[model samples]
Target: MSFLHLLAKKSKRRNVKLLRHLQDVASIAMKIARNGGLDERIAYIGAILHDIGKASTQFQKTLDVNFRRPPGMVFRHEIASLFFLSLVDEQDRPAVIEMVVAHHKSIFKDIGEMGLLDLNDRLRDCFEVHAVGFDIWMPNALEILHHLGLKVNPITKEVARKSFEAAVSYCEVKRIGYSKWKGLLMAADHLASDMESEVGDILPKLFITPDLNFYNQQSIWYPLSFIPGNDPRKHTLLKAGTGTGKTYFLLKRCTGRIFYILPFQASINAMYERIKKDLMDTDAEIHLLHAASLLQGNGESLKEKVLQRHIGASIKILTPYQLASLVYATKGYEALITDLAGCDVILDEIHTYSEDAQALVLKIVEILYSLNCRIHIGTATMPTALYNHLLQIMGGKEQVYDVSLPDNVLDTFDRHIIHKAEKIEDLGPTIRDAIKDGLKILIVVNTVERAQKLYRWLNKENLNVDKMLIHSRFKRSSRRALERLLQNDFNRKEKPCWVVATQVVEVSLDISFDLMITDVAPIDALIQRFGRINRIRNAHTIGKYKDIYVLPPPKNNRDARPYKLEVLRRTYDLLPEGELLQERKLQELIDKVYPEIEAPNIDLNAAFVAGKWRIRELYHAPKSALLDKLDIDTVPCIIESDVKLYELADNAIRLDMEIPVSYKILSFKNFPQLKIGNHPFVIPDGAYDVDEGLIAASLKLESVQ
Candidate 1:
């Protein structure tokens, strides 16, 4: 049948809604003419015949009154029309085919990697168009075969190629009314498919509208001067005190999608709460994905749908290792590949990673770079070695600039309390004294075994053990549960306890302690761990000052901890006595200390990663491999709702209080002590509550005297 006859049949439905669509198409064509990509005529011609295939009876199966059919059937007419157009002429076929084929996808090619990605100097470009190259599509030759004495035009190879180029050109010119043509077709098509009773089938409908203007409100991020240079393509190394708001800086300036990666589930929980509070009014889809976010809520994939809906959101909160999972991913990476391209990534607490995990992240960064992902390394106390690695990963700061807090704002850092202890034995007493004195303490220890030992000891001391112990020994679910408890405002009667933790607490968990008796380490790490205490406002200046005490070595210490421990021993030995170390001076001290550690290559990029160990390495590349063993698989990640994993711990001390509508996420008969602390945790004990928070702070202590 002739193309005209098909359009005539289309009009028979009484509300063929496309005539209005034709006008819309004409306006778009006019815009194209004025702006000029190919000629205004190409857009008009493409728009007019975009749905010529609606001439087919195949679409009538679903197209009823009000077009109660889905948009797909009607949209297919563009295919038929392209075939019809190819029958006109070779040259016309190529050009017409180009416009028709590409018009529908609204293919965004010119915004090469979100536009201004500097592909000329950076990773990649023009992917959307390149993804549809000439090899994939060819211009069709115009030819007609008489079937039943009727003329039929067939789509040929040449038609595909021209249509592809025209599609790209449309985006390049940003044709004045291109949105109108696209909108009209999309809107008409949807109107045709809508189940309206009165109106007949409509054309596919699309409209042009700007995103909501809510992002423009100016807010105070920092002293403003502490903000880093805004180079999206360059890597930035930041080392600040906790309250300096490193995450806040990264999140605030983050324009496109953001990937905030933390090490553990506990850290993720703390970061998640902060992000939720910060983005409460904003439209960003802040995801708390780990093992928990993947939980199938309400029996329907409502969370999954939200994930899909805003996969390209303004901001996404996730685990850093999850991005690591993607680095060497095979199946799940498909959907995420495009989303991650050119995205800005903020990795918190890099030093907290174990040698194994650190190796994984280093590899992850390398892969992200190849994928055209922009990275911004954020740490409360970024280690010297890490800073160098980040600079290298960002391909060097010769092109990138650094921004830090001014000495003046940093000098105002008389807010912290530092106490030097000689041994780990000294750590407990110091922290106990501080907590008894109403100073919430955060203690950072080197090992998981040590964290557990400290927790038990502090519990024996009748210190509130509930506020203590955040480490890897506990299941991730338990760790997240624990962080929530620590962050809550306990009653005046209840002891606001101290947390004894491994490095897990240092990086992303948002809770803070009043006084921290941390074993000293690198200056950057010391500053980061201090972020947990008095983070929001100034220090509490009542009664005894809640000082962030750094535990010093014994009077005659023999064995000290490892690198972290050694760093702390050296730094702790420097303090004469109680010193109110400011953030900037400490930062300068760290700069001086880590000079040897601040290097990109780290001596062996391939060797450190080449060891044999725990994590199951599955996906492989030339020099790197995906550590599958470390990966907590999301597919089987969830256990039965009644499984013991979700059940409360047996020894948890129960506290009966009306949990807030928000806080009461999971409730049970014997819920593990997320916040139910019976004994008191001494504030002076600080971040190293033994098993709870540590490593992330860059601290360690003398083994013994």
Candidate 2:
């Protein structure tokens, strides 16, 4: 066989001869394996043989325009790769075979049920004689191996059959489980496959950062700047105030690729811009991930999606839940986990998630810790119990860099005066008075229905201020418009206006108000809400300490599904009324309200625990459907009357018209939906006011009755 005849097909990303793919992948795997302290030779050999099966005639024919495989002759080159494992040393054979067979598919799956992966049945026909000649294709494969400086004995029917049996035996031994070598092979293959024509441009290094100190120009608070930079070998946990430069602090410690996680999309969108503009000193690549990642208007091209998922980047700004897909072992989880292993993960605003989400976050921390990832957790509010739990997860206190802001640094950020209110409506006079005084005011409600109701009441009063309303229920396009307005006008506004919002405004938008009125929530949540008022830490402002009125929570448990009534009561009682809201008091209040770990229900936990030991679970790439059970129920919907909006959604350029509403009010299965590409756009037969957003169809039907 000719040397070139043994080569695999050319890569779609670059025009190099296919032989280079295996060599490049081996080089990268060696580097990664060495970094993780694993046997680099095993990694190198695993990568070298991963795609060797592609040298078979059947696979090459698939590349031919006029050729097709004979009926019942399926192409499963990953399985075919096992036929070449005879070249590997017996000691390294298990690792190499595991990486080769599972490179494209799972080794632990029900191979007997999979048509292509069922080695016993699928191999018989391929090995059988054809009209032209004997169908054994190992000659070209061995020639290619020899060209690459490897020697393999001749392939006989008995030798090939024995090699396949050895591979299956290695998989049956669960002691091997998931290995870093396998992860490295997956990462290396993706990186090599994505190399653009010039292979020299893609280096064997880990990640890139600018040489200059990016933090020197900003006036960093004490302790924040004083904390030692991260040691990639250890884990880190930190607590600091809102305006204390925590984001910059965390970025300073990152040694390799970064995964900066936040809770909400609005926060992630805002952070994506901040990182790109301020933190990026070089032309380092970065990607934004969320439900709207595929949205077109964000300058996202189809090519970028391929590059982002496989080629990866130096940094990625996303929600923690995006990384939680690994727990479910979702499709492409291996690639995601490979990119994350040994990387710097900055988890911000971790206290804002729901109970199930919180459980999932802790699971993520446990998994990332096992994967040798450098975890840096930053929080503005964390209960002592939760802090201790995280420390335990990192192997007691010794293994983690436990850092917090000094008292002097914390004292400077004390900017709020708290007051208790009998009812939210009772604060209407206070809001009107603040508006009359030409003070920019922000009112935060616990629910979307309440936010809309309050907005309508305030508009009817006609307080003569430019008023705006925002909540999670607004369409994606409308929410973006509203966020833009908040950033442009209210963020540093010279004029007075009232912005009524829900908890969506709590975490990441850069808007500061002269005064705030909010419903009673957990102390941690309340602190996040209070952050929006006087957020920039301007000490000498006209109103040095802004006023915040906390309305009592709903009287009954039924109306308090969004928040825990007991926690809210404790939060209200512990807050110092008629005095400045000390950031230091936040920890004490949070500890009293949430002392124990919050996790998903018994059933969900059981499901996760049951699959924990099943090796097949790791290979099972489930869909996003797994998230439906984990997330707080919300459904994506569009207003039925908006024809132009539907057309825009159909084009899938921007999802500004799709909004997420409570699934409790709308049955997910009953909605009349349209599939635009991968996204499902639902049309609800309910009155949708520009200001109120989507009214639940069930509510509309009840009204009609």
Candidate 3:
């Protein structure tokens, strides 16, 4: 018989042949299984056979750009792949079914009711439809599997039908909890599809152990550096203020691969750059993982960008949301668990999380502990109650290296004087005087609208000094540009400028300004904002203090969103008006503001509870419902003019053009949307300003350029 040529994937550039794609997936799967402590043969066999059903002419025709299926015509290749289950041993058949059955769709309660069980109920002839051309494709699939080193036996259509029936029976009787087998195949399949032939070269570079000797150097200026990190404890919890070398201290405590978690994008980016530069001499593969991580890799090649996203870097800097997927059992979670097994994870700024986020972090800590990972937590403003709770979770003092600075040492880090103002307008005279004195001024606000209004007001003053505004609403590329200016130009000690920003300036920025005039936020958030002023602490500057003025809290809940009104009022009352903001007293003041921390009631939705997995064994959640519960929904959008470039550009460029918009805003306004890569909605061009960012209130549909 003539050899049948089948395609597995098609892009605008080229078509990927089924045989080559399977080989690549199998090779990657084998390596992952070896590293993840799974059965390598099971992974390889599952990967090789995962997409064999694509050989059916029905699936092949969909590869054509002009081909469109009839309405309500549902053909699932994964369901079709199950017909050949008899090719594997009966003992291994269950595992293979888990891998191939729902690699693309869920097994039960899937979104749109498109899962296999749903298909079975909706289509009485589902088996006949999927098995239409199985007889013709069986020999071709067997030949391909045999070439890939799998032992294949000739089987008739009837035998394959029986095998499919048995697999369906097995799935129906399967127990609860997600399947690591499914996660393995999904991870391998995604990598293979994205990297194609390059998967082999990248597989070996994963799970690298980094050299952390650079952080071993001790310094008298940084007190935390004087303490030893190589203690016998399994975990470390360090309580120290900003600029005390907490990052270096936490890094010193790590012994394996590191996943450094930060709460903000600015901080994560800063840490990634800092670590990459510090470890330039080592051959460790350091990667930055986040939504805008690609924007951070401006000069890097496409291969480097691809490498940054894949699992198993020596040091991966990211936000907790990346790891939260494991808690929710999102797709590819098994691969995450496999990579994170026995690694060192650093959770920096643990106090910055909201109530719900704090509860989620606690759950993540529990899961990390179960995975045998050494957890290191560093914080400048953690409440006493929360701190003690974490201590108990980590098995108390016996198992953790709990470190804190003495009161006398903490007094030496006092760098700001606090003053209260009635409103933002009250600081107009002070801002002008500071500008006249040639001092760099930092203005922080509670909302993006306030920041923009303040920047516009300052622009009208004609102060003849550099002025810039930064918030989270700008396009990714524009945000990168603003961040560069903030770090490179405005940060210079000799340069006097005005920077008006929102809460984004709170953490991870290495910039220091001469003075700060800001809104009143939660005590912990205010403490972080104060860190930006006079941030460069040293032996000579210990006693010196820069001034930070706090404005009164907004009255209404709408104006004080993203923070509780009661908390803001309490934080304002606790401020030491016209007095030195003593570093030692901050802990007491913070505790007073947040006396009793409330544990969020989110465990009912979590997949892990009390150190045990609560989800089904081989079934994954249909969607990230936890994100919805947390009210963390954001969608990407582009201006009308950028739609053409966005559609034609590659992933990197498309990411650069995306501006993150709150899903609430889009839904409320009912903005017209466009479907393309990322499905970014379209906005009127007039609604966006390169300098001012999205003008939501000024949006008009008539001028959609």
Candidate 4:
């Protein structure tokens, strides 16, 4: 076969087309423009021509999938791109070059001279060009051109002059001086292929199909049948048991489209993998709203361009915060929210919100409704307060379907009896006993600190930890590594290992822990935790001692203590031994135990007036405090607040799926800049850091502001 055909076979494995590398530049240009870096449209065109070198037959063969950088190719590609642009009209060269030079995440170097140009309204002109050497191409650009049957000189000093002028203009506007001829080509070259659109694009398109068994049973059918295709007159609420497939129904019920909004990154990855496996066979183009969703691809140029088009996607999976970016950060949120309009939303884990967040959700609900969006709530034990809040927000209970009760939620499965621990120390012993009895146990705590403590204690006694503890605070890559290990061989394994975790395991980590020991928060929450146990049908046998244990509360004393570190308030009333509560007891337990009712402090009647706090703040709570309240790993992250990220999508620069994330907390250093994902975000108590830096608990913001 010809070399080009071989390339096509290789390219066939990669999603998207090759010419699109230029499109990555176009996206970067728009990002620059929208960000007010440069006024010239020509810069945008320059971004389109920047990666022309990738078209070389020689370059494509040299790429190895091991993620090694292409040797000596960055400047060659840049010069090739520049030479291609030079072949275009002389006037169009500047805008294109600006896009090209800055496409590899270093355009801010030009912004120092532009002095923070506000290119917002009508596109403004890049006034002054900062001087940088432009003669950047190597011997191959000329040699490859000669080989390709085109006559071209190595980009000359004069041609480099114009390119350098445009490149300088880019940095001046971003206001930060960039390194001169620093590994930019290497940076761009590192972004080797168009892989993001492959599985990354497949995730949103996948959905769970409601089985024939689901409809005959009210419990299964009600939640499983969001049926976004139906009348918009009714609001939908699903309170089915786990393994009843709350997620599947949420995904499958879209009428014209579906939006699966999950609470955590693990869920995001799991859901993405599921959708890619399931729906990618169909015609739909999928989109992921979260930053991770955007990063998982191979062809950097192809991924970059697809990200720019939003891929005209039919399904979008995301976190609520990505949507919140609209009201808070730079322009990226605009695309996310507009996409959210007019779609069916299966909001999983609706009970996870705080009062402030619930209020904000109410506002977002109104916005979605106003835009004719459909809403579906999926949770295990629907919190009364949250349900009631939705009732008031979406109109009323009768107006929305009442598929919340266990009888109506999903009839396909029987409820597993849940027990409450009489004391805290009973946990390790109980977990150990469950494991010895061949039951895989899950120990979920409300805090990462508590989870770590339990895992440490379990290890001290040498109890199995194969699935011990997982939380948001652990390194992201490491967390992913562990989840992969636990999921594949969970059931067929030997010793019982405890997965001590925060809420991260609750949503989408597919393994069923034989039993769970957890602290209580809300009824819906408790039910969700229960979902992780006995998930599949034929869960625990009748004679089996396996069941969930809600840890006992600390003795109530009025010393201003923090309520015994999330000790369940009405534990005695909810469960007695392995016996399930009877109906009357259940009602009383529901009313008295869970905090779903309007907290006395937050008025339900007043409703949120214009000035009332919003739901977006759920993501805004502090690290320590948030850690105190929920089960998540505390780590630094370089959020997409960087203007460069948006610039690539905007100006059409190539997208590399492996965008770096800080495992520790971090702050944004500049627009398009975020804290790297491997370190703790350095945040001060009094001063602000970057656009959307690590939001420390001490610093409070009322809204996305």
Residue-level lDDT of model 3, residues 1-705, one tens digit each, is: 222478887955688889899998888788878877889999988998899888777788889889888997788888878877888988998889988998887766777777777777788867887887777777777888888888888878788788778877877777755677887888778778878767767876777789999999988778999999999999999999988999999999999999999987778877888899999999799998885446566888766687676766899998887787777876567667767878999999977877878787888998898888999999999899989888888889999999999999998899888999898777889988998889999999988878888888989888888989998889888987888789888997576789999887888888889999999999998999998988886766889999999999888988888888999999999898899989899899999998987668667888888778876655666555756666567788899899999988987898889888788777766666777677887888887888888877776666663
Best by lDDT: 3
TM-score, predicted candidate 3 vs. hidden true structure: 0.96
* lDDT string, candidate 2, 546-659, tens digits: 899988777888677687777777788888889987776678778888877665543343223422522352254435445555764555666565545565543344355667
lDDT of 3 at 368: 90
Superposed on all Cα atoms, model 2 deviates from the true structure by an RMSD in Å of 5.4
How many backbone clashes does every candidate have? 82, 1, 9, 90
Q: lDDT by residue for model 4 over 272-309, one digit each (tens)?
A: 66765566456655555554334334333555334422
Give the lDDT of residue 108 in candidate 1: 30
* Candidate lDDT values, in order: 0.46, 0.69, 0.84, 0.47
Compute the lDDT of residue 436 as modeled in candidate 2. 79
Q: What's each prediction's TM-score?
A: 0.53, 0.80, 0.96, 0.56
| Residue-level lDDT for 335 in candidate 2 | 60
Evaluate residue 74 in candidate 1 and report its C-alpha lDDT on the 0 to 100 scale: 19
Error of 1 at 143 (Å): 26
Sliding window of 10 residues with minimal summed lDDT for model 4 = 614-623
Q: Which candidate wins on TM-score?
A: 3
What order do candidates take by TM-score, descending?
3, 2, 4, 1
For residues 1-705, write the lDDT of model 1, one tens digit per residue.
Answer: 332222212432254433344444444444433322335555555555565444445443334546465552212344444444434444554445444443333233212222211221242322222223222221211111221122344444355435434433433444221222332333323333232232221111111111223333333434533454455545556665565556656554445566777776566656766765666665555555543333212222332322421233445566665655344432223234444556767777776654556666776677667656667766655556567766776678773446566676665444665666556675666666766676666667755656766766777778753465766534333454565666665312245566777666666656656666665655555566766666554434312234666665433333344335555556666553676665566645665556554323322322123221111111112212333334332211111221232234221111111111111122221222322222211111222223443222322122111
User: Least accurate stretch of 10 residues (summed lDDT) in model 1?
Assistant: 654-663
